[model samples]
Target chain A: AQSVTQLDSHVSVSEGTPVLLRCNYSSSYSPSLFWYVQHPNKGLQLLLKYTSAATLVKGINGFEAEFKKSETSFHLTKPSAHMSDAAEYFCVVPPNRDDKIIFGKGTRLHILP
Target chain B: EAGVAQSPRYKIIEKRQSVAFWCNPISGHATLYWYQQILGQGPKLLIQFQNNGVVDDSQLPKDRFSAERLKGVDSTLKIQPAKLEDSAVYLCASSLGLPGPETQYFGPGTRLLVL
Candidate 1:
């Protein structure tokens, strides 16, 4: 089974600061990775995905993630954080066979003004 | 394109009562999924369907939960004699179901509160 672990449960940052959400994945081989965002009382929206094509995956809202096989990490980052960026971020992994997708416990981001 | 749709954005029920939730996937999407998300926990896959056929439902508690996708487009999940643990958000998602990994679009989710 493929799974992802989010390193942080909560992260607080000042506005316009860099944001880093770490994620480590466990898989026997190359795995499909994704990032999703969920706002308060809203459905989850796909931020980005890496399907074994590119090492650097760019997502919406100026967010991006890098897939590093050596480290088994697919960490999400942003150069600058906006107030609207405060939300729950989830790291996702899907099995190679495409049976189902697994989501991490989620990292809650708080942007301070 | 319109995203997946789920009915009853919120529901309140007492223990031992029954409730049903409905979902409609994106147009022409062959794969649909249902998940249960408790507070402070990640969403757990309850069931998945590929064009009206069950692909994986090993995690679903079949004893009190039942789900059906009659025409491969609309789906429903029902809980009988609900328990307090059943209080959670039910999310519905759909994908194109191509040969490889695909992006899943999620619905607004139905929040159920079992008191």
Candidate 2:
């Protein structure tokens, strides 16, 4: 069995400041992790994914995530948060390779100017 | 390079009423998924189809929820007598194939409000 836990329900960051969203996972098999961003009434946009190849993964719009196996964590980060970066972010874990992608409750990022 | 598409972006109905949502996956994509996302929650898998065959439906409420993929390209999800708790966003996603590790493209989703 596999599951994901997003530590924070919401995060607030000032524009041009750094941003971090924490996620942890538990899986019996090799885990495939992903970070997705969803704007209001928009579809989920893939931010980044970790498939065992690289520990640090970069995605669109200056977003990135690091997959730490020892820590059992995949946390998303951005050097500078933009005003448009405000959105709901989800951490996903596909445990068994089927289409059963388990999602985190979601963290709503608030960008303060 | 068209992405996944879903129709009936919003729906409002009273309890015990039935509703259906449609989805069209990306071209040449063989895997399709339907997910239910309650407010403040993540998307939960409702059903998955691989080229017209069901891959998984364990989380689906079999009593009232039914889904099918016709011709392996388009799919539909139906809920008869939807309950108040069923009010949520129905998201449709599609990927390339099994053993995933592949990015699943998602649709805008259908927001259902059951009163």
Candidate 3:
């Protein structure tokens, strides 16, 4: 079985400041990790993924994340935040050969002016 | 290329009523998925289909919820005797079903409200 956890239920950041969203996972086998963002009343859009390729993965909207196997963490980060970045973010683990993708609860992001 | 498509962007119904949602995956994509997103939560997989066959549906509430993917193209999810907790946004997604890893493209989602 595979599971993911989003550490924060809500995160508020000032515009132009840095942002971070934390996630951790427990999987029996090597896993595929993904980050998705959802705007108000909109469906989720893929942000980035870590599939055992590179430890550091860059994504759309100038966002990026690092996969740390030792810590079992995939934390999203951005050097600067924008008002438009306010949205709900999810961390997902695609199913392995036998398991299906498992999603984290989610983190609501708020941008302060 | 067109993204996934879903119908009746929104629906409102009373508890115990039945409601159905439809989805059309991207052309040539053989994998389709249906997920439920409640307010303040991440989307949960209700079902997954590889072509016209079921791949996974362990979380689906089979007693009141049913889904089918006919002809390996379009799919529909039906909930009979719906409950208040079932109220949420239903999302449809598709992938190229390529060997290795690929991104899943999502539809706008259909929001359902049960009163």
Per-model TM-score (chain A alone): 0.96, 0.96, 0.94
lDDT of candidate 1 at residue B57, scale 0 to 100: 91
Ten residues in sequence with the least summed lDDT for candidate 2 chain B: B96-105
TM-score of chain A of 1: 0.96
When summed lDDT is taken over every stretch of 10 residues in candidate 3 chain A, the lowest stretch is A94-103
Instruction: Fill in the DockQ of model 1.
Output: 0.60
lDDT of 1 by residue, A2-111 (tens): 88999999999999999999999999888888899999878899899898998999999999999999999999999999999999999988866564667779999999
lDDT of 3 by residue, A1-113 (tens): 77789999999999999999999988897788889899986767889888889999999999999999899999999999999999999888876643355667899999999
What is each predicted model's overall lDDT from 0 to 1?
0.91, 0.91, 0.89
Docking quality of model 2: it rates as medium
lDDT tens digits, residue span B2-115, model 3: 788999899999999999999999999889899998887778889989999998899999999999998999999999999999999999988877643345788999999999
In terms of lDDT, the poorest run of 10 residues in model 1 chain B is B96-105
2 against 3, candidate with superior TM-score: 2
Candidate 1, B-chain TM: 0.96
Interface RMSD, all models, one decimal each?
A: 2.1, 1.8, 2.9
Question: Which residue pairs come into collision in candidate 1?
Answer: none
lDDT of 1 by residue, B13-110 (tens): 99999999999999999999999999888889999999999998999999999999988899999999899999999999988886443467789999
